[model samples]
Target chain A: MPEGYLRQSPLASLGLAARAATAADAAGVTMGERERVMLVNLRGDGVDRGFLDRVRQALEVDLPAEPNTAAEGTRHRVLWLGPNEWLVVAGEGEQLAAALDAALAGLHVSVTDISDARAVIALSGAQARDVLAKGCPLDLHPRSFGPMRCAQSRLAKVAVLIDQRDDAPSYDLYVLRSQARYLWRWLDDAAREYAVRIIRP
Target chain B: MLLITCPFCGPRDESEFACGGEAHIVRPADPAALTDAQWADYLFMRKNVKGVHFERWMHSHGCRRWFNAARDTVTHQFLAFYKMGEQAPDIAPVSYTARPAPRTDPALPADPALHTDREGAR
Candidate 1:
């Protein structure tokens, strides 16, 4: 075994180094690879009242039934992926899947704890949309795909689930763990023109 | 480049979807009762109609749900997009082609890249 070695984060080496963004341009984008986030996947019949109710009871947040919409609670963010599938995101809520699994017992459902299967990347600032538009296909306009709206698409050939967070117009992108480094590189390169500022984890 | 109006996710770029050929092909209730030719016909016979077509499309990269769309093959205009179990609209082909319905974004103004509809149609 190595005497002095430490594990590295998905984007530890590749994240744009943190620096003071100059005021020359409209607030250059700031990006950070969010760590210690919990991601849970839920698959159940959304139309079933019982299923929806139990999920709400488990997470204390209602499941978003509308397509491409996100139900953002202070503690949890529920993103609708399909008629019967959703992704629940939070900050280090390790017991969420177990809670939901216990509560949803005896039903046709699946609650998987996928926190380790993916990494979260946050892109924020005035030029955030422009940075994402370099590879993502979704129309990232404020009017059409505004805040609270979420969509799953391929960003630079890597599948990502994007949530338009705020009018800072921040975006939360969830990518597979295996592709996190590559996607980070793609985003960093895309944001170069806008003078990206990397925030510390 | 087709801007598919997913019944669940609204209109999204065609890049987010995968077109499955020929919707509404049901399996026979009793395959044992069918003749060999009938089984073959059921498996391989899909209308290669050049005009209006009914096909299945999955929002593979988005909601991951599938829906039916009735669209003109030649003009590349979408007539209707409905849920999985819903029936196709009753507009005649004459009206469907004479004045093709505009492709609504289902959310906002159109994106210019969605004009070409014939992708994955080899």
Candidate 2:
């Protein structure tokens, strides 16, 4: 186990395991948490080839050049937050932040380990899109948003980063730690009509 | 719902954006040398145009970047969106031919039901 602080999931008190077992009989929506994952915020000039080359050498994947897109690597996934900023989601035990700091040593860039600032909630299954579309105004159709695509938008009136994980149509919502509970309750209420399963992180 | 296009992130809902008031207002280089009236003018005065207003907007919930946009206040039609430090697009003076003028003609008859001759109707 890692530190005790990192061991506790944000939704620990929600009794999600029991709820998930009850809803397992149906197959509408499956919700889970990916707690204590490493989240690093990286910022550098996208136009600078040198910076891009350094990041690619470090992570073995080119930082996504397009807006609202994500690039997945063997051990890490980079989501584009802005033209010059990205969020690096890596395994909890990885030292990707130190590696990035060394790789971008001389460059005018930023690599901050904001691992605990946000909470990740996974929403999947058939009606996941319907549950999201109920609040988010983005065009979540397959053509507009698919696997590896990411967007920063409001869900249930709270700011969230929506990252589409795969064609299973799964999504990982990165919400501020302070508002994670509110977002969870909102999602639970919204997904009540569907077969809602809450899984452990 | 107004769909404002962020320069970096395509079009997004208006709820994701926050307007930063009128755009292209340069601050004076020498604030200490200016009179109170001049300083107040620069601080308080703003153009409230009826159409084709230039304004600054930030995609607060999205990219968190600021950009400029030209929009028609009357129609709420966004004319163009440009990144910061770029020149605002030059649009031809547009005329509003479809919008009707407010009815102020005295020749039009008033509704009789709206008027009553009964006293103490106050």
Instruction: Using TM-score, give the best candidate's number.
Output: 2
**TM-score computed on alpha carbons, candidate 1:** 0.84
lDDT of 2 by residue, A1-201 (tens): 346565666677876766666434676888888877999999999999999999999999999999999999999999999999999999878988999999999999999988878889999988999999999989999999999999999999999999998887899999998898889999988998996877764
State the weakest 10-residue window (summed lDDT) of model 2 chain B.
B111-120
DockQ of 2: 0.80
lDDT of 1 by residue, A45-84 (tens): 9999999988887778899988889997767899988889
The 10 consecutive residues of candidate 1 chain A with the worst lDDT sum are A1-10
Residue B82 lDDT (model 1):
90
Give lDDT: candidate 2, residue A116: 75
* Interface RMSD per candidate (angstroms): 0.9, 0.5
- Model 2 Cα RMSD, Å? 4.4
Show model 1 residue runs off by greater than 4 Å: A1-8, A13-27, B94-122
